[model samples]
Structure formats: structure tokens, C-alpha cells
Target: MGEVEHVVGMDIGGTKMLAVVFDDQFKPVGRFRKKSKAKVPPEQHINNIIQGALDDAGVQKIRGVGMGSPGPLDPDTGVIIDTPNLGWKDFPLAGIVQDHFGVPAVVDNDVNMGTYGEWCFGEVQDCRNVLGMFPGTGVGGGIIIDGKLYHGASGSAGEVGHMTLEVDGPFCGCGKNGCLEGLASRIAIAKEVVALAARGDAPYILENCGTDLSKIRSGMLSRAIAAGDTQVERVVRHAAFYVGVGVANLINVLSPEAVVLGGGLVEAMEDLYLDEVTRAVNDHAMPFLRKNVRIVPAKLGDDAVAMGAARLIHDKLAS
Candidate 1:
């Protein structure tokens, strides 16, 4: 019997972690998911998830491991420079993973990995240039140029969320005012929805998610939208429009063939969000670029980062 050549891809986010085992062909053989518990050190949770996935897959020999984590991080050195959500600073993530598993490991920004995953295996694989904009707790972005991922000089190039959308906008988590994330992210929308509900304007949100702002989530917003809550629809539309505007700016600057939108909010309210975003792009982008660029939803869903991480390992081994 021959040993199977396998690899592991892990996506580490602010709230959760998912580790997947893949065969040489990049097919998922097994997966494990766990809460990240940001207050706690990440090492134990990461180890448990990877080992659990490997155990479930019944694999012993892994060629490599790739991880997608929040940034700003150094992809080349595999160091997490800083991640506010995860409270990690200057952490040698790749080295720790490699030492723990006795295999080569690579780490990059989570959004970058998701973008790469879509570029390699999702709808935009055929395109030479693409942009991935994901709006979750915060907005994250990734760029693919000339069929390869582009990490700017500091490996933080695709920070679409941090781009200033308004000089006097609300403060963002990144300590910036009027950034796209502050205006368009799910968190931003949730904040608006909660405020409206507190003001007795959004009875549906109040009824479903209660008065606690933290209780309001994307699913609640989706349900409220489906139930004909005008307030939810209005807030979502406003956010989606900003997202589209951001996309339009990217199109004008990068001239990408496609812009992929992903994240919980977009996945939940695809048609409503996409329509508004498309309208914004058409309204704001240069006429020629608008006509040529396609705005699409992400196909890979939660597995996008994992698939991208796997691809990263595969590419490294090949090179």
C-alpha cells in the first residue's frame, strides 16, 4: 500500500476556525470547525482542529499545510504582524504550524486566500484580473493580477475596507474614519439596524433579535428582509450601494475582468444586495470599465479560504 499524498488547509477567522484535509487533487477528505475564542491563545485550538481533521480523514503523512488568517500579516515570513480581532502580534504562525505538524506551512491574509481560491477554482479562474470584496464583521478584499495573487509592498495590498469612502464618516475598527468597512460591512449594517430598532422604527428586528445589539446578526437581518421589514431592506440597500461604489472604484483603478462579492450578508440576501451593488457600479464606474466588468457572487462559500490555502501549498510544492 502506498501512502496517500495529502495536505491541510485551515482558515482562521475572528470568530471561528475551519481546517480541511485535502488529497493531492485538492479534494476535501475531511474537515473540522471550532470557535476561535480570541481571548485564548490560538495554538491549542489550531492544533486540535488540524489533528481532528487528519484523524477523521485517516491520514498520517501530510505534504504541507496552508493557513489563511486575519491581517496585517507578512506572507513571505509567515508572521502575523497584527490582528485586532485575534489579538495576535508578531506571531510566527507558519513556523509554529510547521513545527507542530512536521510539514511546510504557509500563511496569508484570509481574504487573500479566499480571493486566490476563487481565482483558482471559482467563477473567475479564466479571468486575468479579478477582485474579491467580502463584507462580514469587517470588509476584506483580495486582488488577483496576471493570474497571480498580488501582495503589495507590505503584504497588505488588498485592504479595500480601509479605503476612505468619506472624510467625515463613522470611525472604523482600523482606527480610520469613513472607511468602506465602517459604512458597508455587515457590522456596519447591523449597527444601523439596531439603532433603528432602538428608536422603535424596526419592530421586526426588535422582535426577532431582541434589544441587545450583539444579538442582531446577518440571519436575523435576512429574515427581517424576507418578512417585508422595510427598515432592514433600507439599511441593507444603503450598505450594498456603498459596497458597489467601492467595487466601481476598484474597477476603475484595476480594470479587473470581474468583481466577486462574498460574505454572510451577501450570501443571505444575494439578489437584493447584488442588484443595489450592480446599480452603484453602473452609476459610479467609468462607462467602458463598467460595461466590461462583471459583478458576481462568490461560489466557494465558507470553503473558499480553505481551498485557497490548499492551492497555496500545492503551488509552493510545485515551485
Candidate 2:
């Protein structure tokens, strides 16, 4: 065998950071992760997190670095154009990392990475076309056509969340009304629980958050369901219904061989919501679309994005 090249894969998000070293076979050799605090500037904070991971792995040289981050980014130029949660705009992430470490770097949207990871090594490995959706702090989507990750014009093609779900529903952080994310995201669910609590129906959430309705989170609703709170179950079902509606629309349009769902919410509550979403898609999607689409849980779990980032670098270099 020829000399092998090691690679570092990093996932950067609003709340946490992770780094992993991968051997030539793409198996993880080592990993590091930590909560991200607010005080650090974007560039320095990312560098520190990556450097910590490098130290933990006890290696200085690598083939290249791959990074997946929350998007609306320019993957071609490796510029994070803007991420509302991360407070980044027009940031040259790949360039800075390459400059600092003297290795090549590639950056892409997290969802894109997730889909690629699944297609390469997870649930969609056998499929030529796949649609991947991640539902957590917000909603994001990615598509693989003919086994290639399609970065549409300006690298903003797979933004399934911004699609309009309701004409005049809740306002999205992107300043749009009735976007899928505005209606079906974790933040949206938390808002609904807070509203219900304000109306005296969220005792569980109130108790969980220490009587502060403002502190209510989606996990509280999940806990309430675990505690047999009928009201929370009802709220969750309603939220799942919207998510189903949105997903059904994607099934109709994309008509991919597989549709994989990921993210914290999906990983934690998939059993609770999967049936509802699947039913909605089967019932509402076009007959041919429904006939061809296979809805399943993503296989990579929390490591999907990071692993996908590593694969992205590998593919880049291999090509």
C-alpha cells in the first residue's frame, strides 16, 4: 500500500464543538469535544478548539482538515457567508485554518455533510439519490443526486427549511413568515409550550424550568410526555404534524430513493414522531413519489456531520 494520509474532521456549531482524527480507512482514531462559550471571537475560538483536538490526538501533520458548520455558506470558496446562530458573516474559515496549520481545509454546510456521510457510509449507502433532513435548533435539508452532493448555484440549493409552509404563520429568524422552520423547529415547539404554560396548561414544563416559562425548552415537553402529560403529548403531536407536512412536500418534489432524518430532536424523539411524519408523507405525496421514497432514521447519529466533513476532504483530494 502507498503512504496513508490522516485527516482531521471538525464540527462547529452554535452550542458545541467537536474534532476527530480519521485514518486512511476513514475510521475515527481519536476525538475531542467541548461546549462553546460566548466570549471567544469566531476565528480564535475555532482555532483553539481544533488545536485542542490536534493535541489530544498527539499528531501534528495531516492530509487536510474538513469542517462542517451551520450554513448559508459558500462551499466553493469555503466562506461562511452567514450563520445567525454562530454570529458569523463572510468569514473565510478554510483559508484561516489552512494558513494557521499549513494543511488544506474544506468547509461546507452541516446538513450537506450529514447527507454525504449517510450516502457514503450510513443508511443511504446503496442509494443513488437521497434526501437528508436534520431537525434540531432549526430545520435543514440536503440532497444527493446521482451519488454526487449538489452544491447549487451560490451553494444554497438544499435549504428545504426556508420553504413556505404557511402563508401567514409565525415569523422565522430569517425574517420570513410561515417558513417550515418557523412552524416546526425546536424553538417553535418551545414557544408553543411556553404559550400553553402561560395559559396554565404546562405544569410539567413550569416545574422543570423552575416556574420560569421563558426558560421552557423542547426537552421539557419531551419530559412532560415521559411523565404522562397529555397536554404536552398533544403539543408534540401537533408539532410533528407540521414536520410531517413539510417532509411530505420534500418527498413529493425530490422523489429520492431514501429520505433520512437526523439531528437531536430526531434522534431523541424519532419513535414518537416518525409514524406521524411517514403517514403524512405517504398520504399527501404524489403516488409515484410515495411509491419510490423510503423514509428511515439516519444511521450516523451525532457523528454524521463530522464524519461527513472528513469524507468531503477525502473525496476532494481523491478527485
Candidate 3:
């Protein structure tokens, strides 16, 4: 691993898997993408993805591999304890990658890697402590304390979406009621939008997305709003408001140097999310705690987790 030439960062999400190759300096050289389908053979899929990226980069080998996957997981052991969306339980993801690829591999939570990716390479790099919240298929959160990713007792500490905002608000994918994710995730927003479309309250969504939650995506939602779908816009804003509430609670508890927002929802409707989240943070957060905590959209977009993974394995092997 001395004088490393390159490393591969793999991001495994509920719906997609991406492999990115980066040179020693952390510049992305090449990447590959595939659908994450459990029915397919995972070993072959992983092999194909890594090989494809290596081919794209024209590299015969890599020093190490770093992976980011949905949690709750054991980062130390590289085991995914559970991922409700992916239907994996107690899976030894890191071992499989290390053994199959013939290189050292490290695994961590996907959102944690996204935050670390941004903290290391994006706009918030200067901050000593940072909070990352992403609202997508589901809400995900990450925390960095004193320039390091913070893992709580279970290595799953930064689950801000699980915070109960209401006692009986709505059902969440995590099987909880009134969680912020239940009210504010892209999935939640889509569900409401679908209902609105079904009722003819959202003509754009009705005509385009057609009451199908899965068919409704972040960009489409934005387009619907721009097409004069006021109800759809309202649903998105309401979701943003709840996200801000969760952010306010975290601000009071952690007082992170910065609050960075990422994921599809923020990327698409950034203005609405920024305005609503800012307003809610101002109203709900302690005035002193909220002061100077810059909240902004993530710059890295889709590559954050992959780049973060590359940086992590590079540093880890170097150490």
C-alpha cells in the first residue's frame, strides 16, 4: 500500500450501486454504475462493477477499496447489521469485497461517507465540526466532531431522521411513527404528491407522474412546481419545514460548526429547502446556538459518498 497509485470507492444504495476510481491525489479517474438488485448474484455484480471502473481508469490494480452502504452497521467489522431498504441483515460486506478484490477494504455508513466527502473536499472543509442531513428516498444524517466522523456507541449515532417529531404523525420505513423521515423524506413527499395527483389537485403530477409514488422523483417534483403545481410545491415545502425542525434540534444538541444539506430533494428544490429550513431553524433553534452555523446545499452532489470513500481508504492505508 505504500506509494499507492489508485483506490476504488464503492457506494451501494437501495436502488443503485456505483464504483468510482480515484488516483493518489483523489481526483476521480473513472466510474461505473449498475442497478442494485438483490435477485442478481452480488459477487458477480461487485466484480463487474469494480472491473468496469478499473477498465475505465486504465488501471490494472488498486491499493485498497472503500465502501459506503446503508446502515445500521458495524463499521469496525465492516458488517451491515441491518438495512431495511436493502433487506440485508448481518451481512459481511467488507469481508466479501476484500476477499473478492484481493485488497484491503473498509466499509461505513453511506450518509457518513457523504458528509465526510464534503467535509474533506467540498465547501465545508474548513469547519471543525459539521452536521449533514440528506432527504431522499429516506432521510439520512451524519456527524463530524472535531474533524473526524463521529460514531456513537453503536457506530450509528447520526440518525437524525429517527427523531420523533410527532407522537403519531405517520408511519416510517423504519417502522416508527412520527419520525422526521416519515414526514419529510422524498418518499414521504412523493406519497403526498401522489395523493394530490390522484385527487386532481396536482394537474402536472397527474399528467406526468400519474399517482405513482415510485415514478415521482425529485427533478420531476421540481418540474411540476415550475409548471404551476402549487399543491406539489406546498408538499415539498412542508417536508422541508420538518427537516428544518430536525436540524434545529440537532443544532441545539450538537452546535456543529456547519450544517450541510445534500441529496436529491435539496439538489432539486434548493431555494425552497434553503428558505424553509432557514426559517424553521431561526424560529426553532436557540438564537445563540443557531448563530453562525452556515446551512447550505452540498456541492459534490452524487459523487460525495464515492469520493469520501476514496479519501477514507487512502488515509486509512497510509496510516
What's each prediction's clash count? Answer: 0, 0, 0
Candidate 2 global lDDT:
0.82
Question: Judged by lDDT, which candidate is best?
Answer: 3
Residues 17-93, candidate 2: write the lDDT tens digits: 88888888888877888776647776777787778777877767788899998888888889999887777899999
Q: What's the lDDT for all of these models?
A: 0.89, 0.82, 0.91
TM-score against native, each model: 0.96, 0.93, 0.96
Q: Candidate 1 lDDT, tens digit per residue, 191-221? A: 8888898888888888888667777777888
Q: Candidate 3 clashing pairs?
A: none
lDDT for position 257 in model 3? 85
lDDT of 3 by residue, 46-144 (tens): 778988999999888899999999898998999999887788888888888898879999999999999999999989988999999999878899999
Worst lDDT run of 10 residues, candidate 2, spans: 210-219
Per-residue error for 33 in candidate 3, Å, reads 1.2
